[model samples]
Target: MLKGLIFDLDGVLTDSAKFHLAAWNNLAQELGIKLTSAQLDSLRGISRMDSLNLILKYGKQENKYTKTQKEEFAAEKNEKFLEQVETMTPADILPGITELLADAKKAGLKMCIASASKNAPKILSKLGIASQFDQIVNPALLERGKPDPEIYQRAQQLLQLHNDEVISFEDAAAGVAAIKAAHQFAVGIGDKQILKGADYIVKSTKELKLDKIVAVFKRNNKKVG
Candidate 1:
């Protein structure tokens, strides 16, 4: 029984990952490093500091910055990211998401966000859909980031549902791995090859339909049973 849905905010909801990459690029430029698109893509579903470390390692400067300097860089990147997010509005909601959210609410399904971003709340508010979610798992409260089941497990716990009773939707491979590690069904909203670990894959939110998803989940569960 799928009683709840846990979603990853960035790619699954909106294209805020672009803003995040832009901000990270700004910081990298100041540090005399250039970030490639591949490197930026790899940062999806990753924590701020971890992303910074990866960027620094790419520039062969990981050990060059002290803890304080790293913290300051992360803070500066966040300020720029926030500036971009501030311009978001309900119109920015991804295709088919508004309908999906409304349909889920009508079906009495609990919804929550399980994102690596600490700014999840602010992003939600900017999109004007903060009230749609029953909870937003605070990344700060977790000990580990994506690909480690911690955040998704925490989200399931918050929803007061068994692991198998929840479905997690994500766009990143890391986020899909986290959902699978938590023993929940994962619906990947991206290329099939990139999110092969997911139980199901949809090209975009526009392909998400509650009835079809519920049917697929039931069939998958039956096979497992």
Candidate 2:
């Protein structure tokens, strides 16, 4: 039986990924490099420095930037992201998320956030839903980011649940890989093709009902142990 629900923040609970993308795009403009949607998508569930590196690598211009310049550029992008997120409120919570959270809580499941975002706390607070989580695994605290399982492992540890007892929701491939690496059930929350590694894939959070989620998980596993 599932005892915990771990969610990814940017794409799962909110639409802050758009803000991040926009900020990165602004950064790309400043750097005289163009970031395609695919490139931006690849940056999901990674650190700011990793993202900047990916951008640099993609443009084959890593040799052109100094470490300090990279840091400054990341900061410039963050400023724009902060501006967009600062105006967010509860209304910014994605459709069906409020209800899903309430239903999960009522079912006695421990809820936590296992996001790669360093701004998880700030974003959750801006959405007026910071209190919704039992524990939040801050990316700043993790030595490695998603696709590295450490973040989800920390979240499971804090929730006091075994890996198999927790189910994680993610929209990014790296996020799914992390959850899977942690030995937890992974639920994908977007395009099936991109999110194919997930144990289960739901087109949107709106379509993910609590009962159905558990039912699906149970169906896939003969036993949780």
Candidate 2 residue 162 Cα shift, in angstroms, is 0.3
Look at candidate 1 and give me any clashing residue pairs.
none
lDDT of 1 by residue, 1-225 (tens): 889999999988888988998899889999999888888788888889889999999899999989999999999999999999999998888999999999999999999999999999999999999999999998988888889999999999999999879889999989999999999999999889989999989999999998899898999999988
TM-score of each: 0.98, 0.96
Residue-level lDDT tens digits of model 2 in 75-185: 888889899989989888888899999998898999998887778899999898888899998778779877999999999999999887888999899999999999889
- In order, what lDDT does every prediction score? 0.92, 0.88
Off by over 4 Å in 2: 223-225
